[model samples]
Target: MSLPSPSPFPPPSPSAAFRPPRLLALAGPTAAGKTDASLALAREFDAEIVSVDSALVYRGMDIGTAKPTAQQLAAVPHHLVDIRDPAQPYSAAEFVADATIRVAQIQARGRLALLVGGTMLYFKALFDGLDEMPAADPDVRARLEREAADRGWPALHAELAAVDPRTAARLAPHDSQRIQRALEVYRSAGRPLSEFQQGRPGRGLRPAALLSLEPGNRGWLHERIARRFDAMLQAGFLDEVRALRARGDLHPGLPSMRCVGYRQAWEALDAGWTPAMLRERGIAATRQLAKRQLTWLRSMERRTVACDGPDPVGDLLQAAREVLR
Candidate 1:
């Protein structure tokens, strides 16, 4: 895909010796045009794009994740994409550490740091401090997986509800990966996950000047999500998943496989789901992901721009100016 020309969008006037180590974030739900807007803002401000997306970090998962095209990546310097193999796990805390270093490095080079993507959890961890939560214990996770095998994930989610109602309330009962993690934390730390989430500042924007693209019309976003998923399918999303499966090192349980479209495609290939089923389920799952993303965005403090109509990047540019000015 061709990158949008920044010529039409005039650059902002340089201020008198601006603050150093500056950061800006362009956040929105999936399929809401974040990449295009991010590219424009990064170019106008001479910013390096530091992707805040969780899935984009993993290598070889591009087609489904709507990752920036090669041409686009060549056009703008993007940090944190394709940094890890699909077999490895990336946490929000890890993202914070990597992004912090990259942001400083970009500023050191006399460029702006633009954090951009749809991963709300990573954004939260970067802007707001994370509590000293226990690291993921493999033994605990293995135990939870075994118990889930016997009693099923819904049963485990029920157990989690018993310990961490606050966390449980936000999660769906069937979300196995998160259910397993929450239970693993509770079992290993002897404390509820909710407790760790508490006492940390709620919804912060630490050094990143925040701008959000929120859809004013939910239907418009839904349509966009559906159309985008279909486009991904046509563009060989299944082939990407097939390649990952052939690696034999990855599984549906891994964080990389658990990404929205990849998860569905994996199951479809395993269970012989029809193309119609894959498209239907993939589109539905993407819409749900977008819904969860919008929910996360609403909780944070941000300068909002409507993403529905034309000139959203223009609006986002204006919002960034407001935050930076």
Candidate 2:
């Protein structure tokens, strides 16, 4: 992709000098044109792209993550995209730490840092910072996993209700992972995760601007999602999933495996689902993810720009330049 021309706008004033390094965050739902827009903006600003996506963190999980291709990667440097194995876990705290280092490096090089992704939680972690939650206790998690396997998530839900009713009330009965996490935290820390989050001060990095691209037409967005899934299939998403599965380290319920397309692919493999069924499920899951992204964007009021037209990249760069000015 060709780089867009530099913005004509002047930089921000000196009074804003004490601000943390200016970060351009491009966020939107799946297929809302974040990748293309970030690429263009990075070129225009001489910035490096730091991915805030959870799925893209895992190695050997390419096509479904919609990771940039070798050609595209060569166009501009991208950070934290494929830094971990499928079996290893990466968390929001880790993201913030790594991203902080990357941002500093980008600034030292006299370039800006542009974070781009659809992962709402990742973006939230960067901006609001994570609570100083305790590290996961493997023994506790293993015990919970065993309980879930034996008696199922309802039993876990009941346990959570007894200890942390607030979290239990908020989670669905079938939301095993979150329920388990809540219970684990309550047991280990003697406090609910929500309470911990509330106690934390504003420790997150505030971006210079937050640009969100939301299509007014859901139908159009869904169509784009379907097309993108089809392209992923054509681009070997299934093979990538299969390779990750063969690693014998990834479980379907792990955070990495639970990413939209990955979960669907795992389910298809487990149920002996046909190729057509897998593709259909993947597309549906991606659409749902997009809806969630839209909801997140809508709830964030400040520094948000809604793009409803065809040329979101053009509008996004113009908006970023405006923010810089």
Candidate 3:
């Protein structure tokens, strides 16, 4: 991984009135109304949105990623959405560089920048900065891919356990992509990723406030996830997956392919599963994702302002105003 260079431009003048850009990060699980709430707050503050989503960055991945529509995007200036091709790899370090430039531009124009999405790793990269880890070698990855094909992910996971037992312990046995990457990184860099993360210096992208949209009812959010998966199917999510698969770039074990809906879609394509089965599996995967997201939010040091009602837009805007003040 490449370490980000320091900003080339000089810092803003040190006038007492000079306000560094205020980033209001709206974060939460999938189907949490983040897009709706962020748009509302953008309108209220005349702010531009810089997406913090990992999946939404890919082009032609709109419906499944729950990306905002073109009309919605036209309503407000949004950055970092639909910015990369499906085959392109986007790292958190790259996001920080792109978003930092956009945020600075927004500040230069005297407008607020609202950072919104569910990708926690991106947020951490922006605030804490990334370690100067080694670059990935395609040859190494190809070799690992061949190994994984010959001997399944479980065997690879066992290999990782021997090399990086601490990392393997935390990851699920089926999390092949992460496990593979971890092992690859350790072998390539000759350093444990866990060890590199310890004692890193800070580069502050800390927001004036970090708010998560926690709906009052967990069941309501779960129902929302189920409904969203159904909507994705109606919107041709499987067709999108088929197109991606046709590219011969669909690495089933890769993180991108293993995303909630994509995993189920891949299973459907491979097993000749029915549409209903696909839908059921996708919904279950989304619920699991939501559960993990909720667990992450709970672990945050920031106290999220919970919204009690269905329409969280009003509460989000009010919270933004309070934070800005």
Candidate that scores best on TM-score? 1
Clash-forming residue pairs, model 3: 1-134
- Over 75-136, each residue of candidate 1 has an lDDT whose tens digit, in order, gives 99999999999999988778878998998898889888898999887877776657778998
TM-score for each model: 0.90, 0.85, 0.86
Query: Candidate 2, after superposition: displacement of residue 123 in Å?
Result: 1.9
Q: Provide the lDDT at 208 for model 3.
A: 64
Clashing residue pairs found in predicted model 2: none
Model 2 ranges off by over 4 Å: 1-21, 150-176, 198-202
Show model 3 residue runs off by greater than 4 Å. Answer: 1-21, 154-170, 197-202, 247-255, 308-311
Ranking of all candidate structures by their lDDT, best first: 1, 2, 3
Could you tell which candidate, 2 or 3, scores higher by lDDT?
2
Q: List per-prediction Cα lDDT, in the order shown.
A: 0.83, 0.78, 0.77
In angstroms, how far off is 296's CA in candidate 3?
2.9
Relative to the true structure, candidate 2 has a C-alpha RMSD (angstroms) of 5.0
- lDDT by residue (1-325, candidate 3, tens digit) is 1111232223445783357546668888899888888889899888999999888888878788998999999999999998887777787778989999999898788898898988876776776677877777778888888988899888888888888887776556666667777877898998876564432334647566677787668888888888888888888999999998998976676557767688778889999999889888888778777776676666554536675474567767776676566
The candidate, 1 or 3, that scores higher on lDDT is 1
